[model samples]
Target: MDELSVKCLLHANDQVILVPSACGLQEMVNKMNDFVKKKSVKVYVGKTKVMVFERGESTTECDLIIENEKVEQVKEFIYLCSRLQIIANMAEISKKRMNADNKVNGA
Candidate 1:
């Protein structure tokens, strides 16, 4: 989670657990709200976003809400001046590393 950008990351191994449905996500936010209230910290719900990085027919339009305020769903959003994308596969990560090394080696 990047506080300055007001972004959060929720990751899970798809094989081990199920990604929550829209209703389930709402329940999570409600729980989070309760926790925040206990700590006396206010959550800036306006900046909240929901990003899902699955390689399938997943819903990009997540109707997640906090305090009845709608949170946005994004694809390929830039954060901290860098495009943040999910490295879904091990091969992709290896390919990216190879490319970076080649560039540094002036190839």
Candidate 2:
């Protein structure tokens, strides 16, 4: 996915709990919370206020702004997420890649 899509995924705050497939959702949540708590950063998932740390405070706005000025950083984050997804689904991806390679090579 592109940077915007990745950002959207990170910023979504719907009540519906999406069961993450291969990615560690709990770890992501914990890291996100820790980022806010440690950095004292404000974060918001749309209009819904997100409480980063249970014992800390809530983030009404995003301190880590995703603007055009930070395009490189955003791209890096997106690349990292993509790499994580690939690592998480390595077996499936390997199979697909092998199949495609075989087809291309007429094997």
Candidate 3:
């Protein structure tokens, strides 16, 4: 059996974990809960959120728990200044010209 590794990103005091499957994702969450308790650190559960990026047709369902509490799942979340939108909520905006050329062309 091959040992699967959890892919994680650490930036300052923030941590981001990405797993291939829902099961793996849940396992990682559980591990994190244990780690925080052992280190005697506080986890801002209310500020924590979980998001699964997948195709529009595919529904990726996973329950993420922190400190025995379920974390909020959001379709679109703003990270830094950019907004992370899901496929279902993705849209395109087009801007039309407000005014046409004032001067008429001399033929």
All candidates' lDDT scores? 0.61, 0.37, 0.67
Candidate that scores best on TM-score:
3
Better of 1 and 3 by TM-score: 3
Clashing pairs in 3: none
Model 2 CA deviation exceeding 4 Å by range: 1-23, 41-107
Question: How far is 101's C-alpha from truth in model 1 (Å)?
Answer: 2.9
Q: Give the better candidate number (1 or 2) by TM-score.
A: 1
Q: Using lDDT as the measure, what is the rank order of every candidate, best first?
A: 3, 1, 2
Q: For residues 19-106, could you state the per-residue lDDT of candidate 2 as single tens digits?
A: 3231343344445556666887643433332222222232223232221122111111122234212122457668979999999999
lDDT of 1 by residue, 1-107 (tens): 12222224444311111243343656656766788789987667665556777675445677777777887776655644567665667887899999999999995
TM-score of 2: 0.23
Candidate 1 segments whose C-alpha is farther than 4 A from its true place:
1-23, 57-59, 76-84, 87-98
Residue 67 lDDT (model 1): 76
**Best lDDT goes to which candidate?**
3
Name the candidate, 2 or 3, with the larger TM-score value. 3
Query: Cα RMSDs of all predictions?
Result: 9.1, 15.3, 7.4
